[model samples]
Target: MRVFLLTALTMIAFAANSVLNRMALAGGGIDAASFGSIRLIAGAVMLGVLCALLRGGLTLGGRGRVAGVLALLVYIYGFSAAYTVLDAGLGALILFGVVQITMFAGSLVAREAVPPRRWIGAALAFAGLVWLLWPGAGPRISVVHGLLMAAAGVGWGVYSLAGRRSTDALRGTAANFILAAPLGVLIGLALPTGAAGTVIGAQGVALAILSGAVTSGLGYALWYNVLPRLASSVAAVAQLTVPVIAMAGGMIFLGESLSLQFVAASVLVLGGVAISVLPLQGLISRSSGS
Candidate 1:
């Protein structure tokens, strides 16, 4: 029950990241790149302080640290860039869908055996995602934006896998953010002419800070703490809630409407993921054996 609650809270925080970004960007307060850079810097600072207070200091002198930093960079920039054009709900769907697929792929690559039922469930979830996200017959997504989001998904998957080996979640996340912060800032500076001017004023800065320090930095640490206690399938299935939660956040906070199609798609996707992840047979067998 505690793990379930923590998972729910983590999903809420993850969903809020989209809501906050939409508010900042659509309001003309911040550009995607600038917002991304600010998020990394602020998150780095916040996590650094927390690590210092909690652990007496911070260190990144391990193999996992290097992987975490690289993955963090990919996720931060790719996420920021993808949102420049994608709607909040659509972006969340793509991001989380890709995350599931990437992590599934990672599991295979690592030789972690996946059961047959899990694969079927993943397929159902993917099919539902395609139904939900596929554009109408009128137009298609830009290749560039699609690639960016895909990269972002891969980055986040790598980050999750890297954190799985960590004994200290807070310290590991802090180190990754701190190492990646300068790179994010440098990338922001290197953007084309007039790009930097898009991010403006205090409101934008505040949103970015909240996204970084509260939702992303702290939320990631929480997730890391939870991962070891969860099965790979459970982790994948749990993330299915993020897009639905993000859609709800969009409707409630951003005045976005809940379309019937989207709602239906959500049901199918979430149900399929749940089916794929739950250990129904294991529970039943244990009960019967007992």
Candidate 2:
């Protein structure tokens, strides 16, 4: 029950990050580059404080440290920029779909023997994503934004893979945020004038801080704490809820409309994820044993 609550909370946090990003960007409260920069810095600060209080010191040196930072930067910037054109729910769907496919492909490349059920599930999910992104007569989704979200998803998948062996998730994550914050600032500064914006109001800054400190920083720490307690399949399946939650939040908060197509695609994608990651292994074992 405790693990379930923690996992649910983590999923909410992930979903909330999408809503908050959309609120900030779509509302014209902040520009993409500045929002990304603030988010990284705020995340670093929050995580650094958390690590110091819990572990006395932050660990900055680790394998894949550079790769993790780079991937994180890519995810952060791409995610922020994508929201400028993509709706929150749509963006979340794309992001998670790509992430699921990327991680599954990575496992195969590493010679992990994937179950046939998982393969079928992944294919279904991929088809759903393709259907959603297909050029159609429905409300148009920007190809540029879709591509950016895909990039963000790939970056996040790589970052997750890099951090798979972490001994201390808090400290390692803090170090990555700290290292990336400055680089993010540089990226923000380098953005074109139209992209970065000239003025940042209090509301925008507040949203960024909340997204960084609460959703990104503390939320991830909670997720790491819960990860060891969850089965790998359970972990993957649990994330399928994020897009649903984001969709609901988008409709309520962002006034985003849900098209029939979006709904259908979501059902396909999430249902596919459920099929892929649900524990068929137990059934397989029982049948074989019998």
Candidate 3:
């Protein structure tokens, strides 16, 4: 029950990131680079404090530590930058689609045995994503931002896999944020400002803080804690819920329009995820044995 609750909360937090990033960037409350930078720094600060409070000291070194930090930077910056043009719901779908593909590929490379039903579920979920993102006339997607979001998805996929091996999820997450935060700042410094009238105000800072501290910082740590117990495919498929959650949040908070297509796709995606992660195989085996 605890694991189930944790997993549910983690998905919600992940979905919330889309809405928050869209809110900050689309509204011109903050520039993409600065928002990414602030998000990383804020997460680092929050997690650093959390580590101290929980463990009495901070431990910053671990296997795959460097890769984790680099991947995290890729996810943070690419996500923020992509949202400059991508809609919140659409971006979440792209990001999680790439993430599912990347992790599926990684599982193959590692030679982890995957059940056939899981593959079928993944295919269904991917098909649903395609249906959602299919370019109609007057499509709002920007080629540049779409590619950027794809890159972010790959980064997040790698990060999620690396996190599965962490000995201490909270400490490892904090260390990665600490290392990545400065790199985010450097990348921000190098980029030329593109959007006019972008400024960070009190509301932006507050939203960023909530995103970084509660949703991202603690949220990522909690996800890491759950990752070790989940199959790689199950983890990937479960994230299909994120886009649906983001879609609803966008409609409610960002005043985005909802379509019948989105509703139908939501059913497919969530149903596929349920098929992948539930205990159908176990039930079948038990019944046959009896």
On lDDT, the candidate that comes out on top is: 2
Q: How many steric overlaps are in each model, in order?
A: 0, 0, 0
Q: By how many angstroms RMSD does model 2 differ from the true structure?
A: 2.2
lDDT of 3 by residue, 11-110 (tens): 9998999999999887787888888888899999989998898878787788888889989989998998899887788788778767766777788889
The TM-score of candidate 3 is 0.84
Best by TM-score: 2
lDDT measured at residue 139 in model 2 versus the true structure, 0 to 100: 46
For residues 1-290, write the lDDT of model 1, one tens digit per residue. Answer: 99989988898889889888877877778887888999999899888988888789998676688888889888888887777665667668767766766777788899999988768767876776677546662124555665687788889989978987877888888888999999888987786424457556699899999999999888876787797898876776678778888888888877876666766766666676676667868878999999
Better of 1 and 2 by lDDT: 2
CA deviation > 4 Å runs, candidate 1: 1-7, 132-147, 192-197, 224-238, 283-290
Q: Model 1 reaches what TM-score against the true structure?
A: 0.85
The better candidate by lDDT, 1 or 3, is 3
Per-prediction TM-score, please?
Answer: 0.85, 0.93, 0.84
Evaluated at residue 84, the lDDT of candidate 3 is 86
Candidate 3: the clashing residue pairs are: none
Q: Candidate 3: where are CA atoms >4 Å away?
A: 1-10, 137-140, 222-240, 267-273, 283-290
Ranking by lDDT: 2, 3, 1
Candidate RMSDs in Å, in order, are 3.2, 2.2, 3.2
